[model samples]
Target: PPDVEQLGRATWTFLHTAAAYYPERPTPNQRANMLNLLHSLPTLYPCSHCASHLGDNLKEHPPDVSGKAALSHWLCQRHNDVNERLGKERFDCTKTDERWKDGPSD
Candidate 1:
């Protein structure tokens, strides 16, 4: 079985990559689908402890799927929340697009 760290890394990679590629101006259906995916994570995620924490966080800070930037920022905040719990450094939310989508300039 995968450990929590492995599961978390894989999950975050998938989420950030997906958010990176999400339409800048998603259609109604796309927004709905993204919302569904986000909402399902807490319940469907394999790590029970992680899932519970995410569920609690979701209640406190509901997702913002208004647009690509909004969604990406929201995910970054959520990732920071997890990092805080793990005593990890917080990622710079401002660099989300560069980190997730575009490579940093040399």
Candidate 2:
């Protein structure tokens, strides 16, 4: 099997994910957490569209976590692309979320 560490992080666009089964508003914490994860991150190892890092201008926009919010919807290149492609196009993953299986690092 391929050395899984070669794989990248999860780039989930919570908006579409949430919109699917939940038209209702999300909890404050949930929304905040999503926003933070999407905003603060610096570099993405694996790009959302392909195997590339996130671009600069792409990184400029602050996630839509405004109005005295505590967190932002930060995304690595991969997840950001998905979020943008939605309605126009989309990508699917054959792999499951495997990173969590590994213990935390120092």
Candidate 3:
């Protein structure tokens, strides 16, 4: 379709721009844990607009970030800004974390 290409480009631009101010820029998810919960994975983490972990910090240097606008966690940075957002009283909202984790650990 002739219009298909133009439409696709426009859609991409809209999506990219919207992600620019996403709150959760990064998230944390254990691969092993994901595997274990293959049947029922709990998406219990913040993610950047680009769908990256809000503040997983599961890397040595910078981390995997989609070329999306939501990836804007910091001032052209990543982890630092995302961390601050997570600490705010919005995502976790304190009221949620206080009762998030239950039972014991191994």
Question: For each candidate, what is the lDDT?
Answer: 0.91, 0.37, 0.32
- How many angstroms is residue 89 displaced in model 3 relative to the true structure, after the best TM-score fit? 41
Writing each residue's lDDT as its tens digit, candidate 3 over 78-103 gives: 32344465573223322221222232
lDDT, ranked from best to worst: 1, 2, 3
Residue-level error in angstroms, candidate 2, position 90: 9.2
Deviation in angstroms for 16 in model 3? 0.4
Residue 45's C-alpha lDDT in candidate 3? Answer: 25
TM-score of each: 0.94, 0.31, 0.23
lDDT of 2 by residue, 36-79 (tens): 55444444334444322334434554554332211122223345
Write the residue-wise lDDT of candidate 1 on 44-87 in tens digits: 99988889999999999999888889999999999999999989
Model 2 stretches with alpha carbons more than 4 Å out: 1-24, 43-55, 65-106
For model 1, the superposed segments whose C-alpha errors exceed 4 Å read 104-106
Q: Is candidate 1 or candidate 3 better by TM-score?
A: 1
